[model samples]
Target: MDAAGLALVLATLRLSTPLGVAAMGELVGQRAGVLNIGIEGLMLVGAFGAFAVGVATGSVLLATGAAVGLGCLLAAIFAWFVLNQRADPIVTGTAVNLLALGGTGSAYRLLFPPERPIVSPPAVPDLVPGVGVFLLVAVLLVVAVAILLSRTRIGLEIRATGERAEAAHNEGIPVMRLRWACTLFGGACAGLAGAILVLWISQSFVEGMTAGRGFIALSLVLFGGYRPARIVAGALLFGGANALQFQLQAAGFEIPYALLLMTPYVLTLIVLALYAGRAHAPGDLARPFVART
Candidate 1:
């Protein structure tokens, strides 16, 4: 590839890093029967948390930790309501997204008054040939999650819970606990994505900086048929679309700016329309598990 082409490829990888990680995380949760729609909120909270802590401590490490920790914490709350209280996952998840949006905006305004300027944190250094450390971490995580879900005993239990919760329970699996763990793990991945955005991609939080990427990741799970390798492919495709948009705009293409901006999402919708219903999903997806007497 030429220099310009190589640059675009690198940019695509960077853009896809967050989406890839988040999608894999959500894939794991869905495999365990936890449809976490609050992923957006968890990511928003993590971004703000990471930005706030990074600014205070001037430590990228602390910022990343805060993001992941906050993500898992929010996931725990979601798990409590959905798993223990039997709350509606859709309703609770939507509420969480709204809360994160409003809460993060308000907190940012309060902490950094109109008179003060927003400070950007240092970007995480590139650890690989062309990508940052977070991107490397995301790739490793994708590989690890893929292996865990496909090659391990816990993986079997998780898949079983999603496929047939009552059956898994009857066979002596802890359905509730497995769901909780998967949800929390998903939250951690979402949080890591947030940290990557704030600390590496954007270097700052702007309330809803996630820009619906969490939802896109959710769609990617479906687009990939809930498979790890396919999820990576979907993420890269989306990332390529984004990069193409940027390149087209940079090249002064005649397309309208709005149309260019909508490229990735438009592609996503088309793909989902084609494959969503046809693809095989877990039988027990989105259904809460209730034990029998």
Candidate 2:
């Protein structure tokens, strides 16, 4: 393939980084027995928060930090409902997405009013060689997360807490605290992904800008069998499909454009159907652990 084709693939990988990170993070959270369904909404909030802070402060770091903070804050609410209040995680998660949609839409309008269909926007920053940088970062992050999830004591504790909280609790593990920590970590990753998108690609906060990548990421956890390396492969596969579609469109091939847009999702559904029963989820996957005899 030519350099242009290589670039296209690389760019697609970069674009998919945030989703990959968020998906892997969600995998960690879910592995511990918690069902967090509000990832999409959390991502939206993170995207908006990062963009608003980045533009105003002109510091990508600050914007990203704020986004992570917001993601964790939002996830806290989810943790409360599912972990403490013992509410239906699915319902609470839906509420989070709806809330994010309304909140982001309103915040964008109120903070940066439109003028002739244009809002006050800053340009997205590009790396000197955009695709190369994102690719390196993606690789490094995958390695780091893999080490964190599988090779460290904390990682083991995290898995222990998620897989069997009550059992871990009996063994003197702080199940609740460990769960909260992992969820917060997941949220932070989601927020960081948002910041990357806002600062490098989208450049502005839009209503529901995260699209449905959050949900896709959640599915990716199991599809990847909770393995960090596998998750990266999964991400690359999906991202490759997206990149190919873009190339096809640019090449002016005779094809229904809609198929390109839906390719990633269709792949996800297929993976879910094929792999759902094979993956070993946490023992208490969706069950709230309380003081039970």
Candidate 3:
């Protein structure tokens, strides 16, 4: 590949890392019949946690840990509301998104006032100068998740839960417990994704740095038809659009900047419109499960 081609390829891989990771987690949760719309909020919280902890301690490991910790914490709360209280997943997810958005924005402004400029923290060390360690980790995670959902007995139970919670329950599967675990795992993946975005890609955190990637990840899961390999392909497709826009702007294309910036989202909408109805979601998706005596 030529220099531009190589650059585009690298950027595509780098950009897709987080989306692929997060989408895989979402796939797992959805397979287990929990649709977590709060993924955006989880990512936002994780990004802030990583930024704050990284700046305070200057340790990449600790910052990443903080990000995962915060993501899991928020996910746990969300699980309690939806899983335990039987709250609507959509409502709870929306609240989580709002909470993360306002909470992070407020915390950021308070911690670093407008007067003082924020500095980027030390990034996760790269495996090779240009290629990030997280890229490799993401690949491994995708493979692991694929195996987890396809080859394991637990995977069967998860699928069973999504298909029919009552039936799965009768079959001796701990439906609620499995959903809770999957939800937490999804949160952890989202947190790690946020860390990758800040520490690996942007190397800094901005208010709402995640933008709508969380939503994009959700779309990706649907676009991929809940399959791991297809999901990664979907992530790459969107990521390539993102990289293309950046390349166009850098090469001084005449396209309007606003138009260029919206490329990925526009593609997302188009893809969804084309495939949304065709894709078959889990039968029990977004439906709250109540155990029967």
For all candidates in order, the CA lDDT equals: 0.90, 0.78, 0.91
TM-score of 3: 0.98
Provide the RMSD of all predictions against the true structure, rounded to 1 decimal.
1.2, 2.2, 1.0
Q: Would you give me the overall lDDT of model 1?
A: 0.90
Question: Can you list the residue pairs that collide in candidate 2?
Answer: 32-162
The digit string of per-residue lDDT tens for model 2 on 208-251 reads 78878888888888888888877777877776777778788888
Pairs of residues clashing in candidate 1: none
TM-score per model over all chains: 0.97, 0.91, 0.98
lDDT of 3 at 30: 97
Candidate that beats the other on lDDT, 1 or 2, i.e. the better one: 1
Q: Backbone clashes per model, in order?
A: 0, 1, 0
lDDT of 1 by residue, 181-225 (tens): 999999999998899888888887786899889999999999999
- lDDT ranking from best to worst? 3, 1, 2
Which candidate gets the maximum TM-score versus the true structure? 3
Query: What lDDT is reached at residue 46 by model 1?
Result: 85
Model 1 residue 231 CA deviation in Å? 0.2
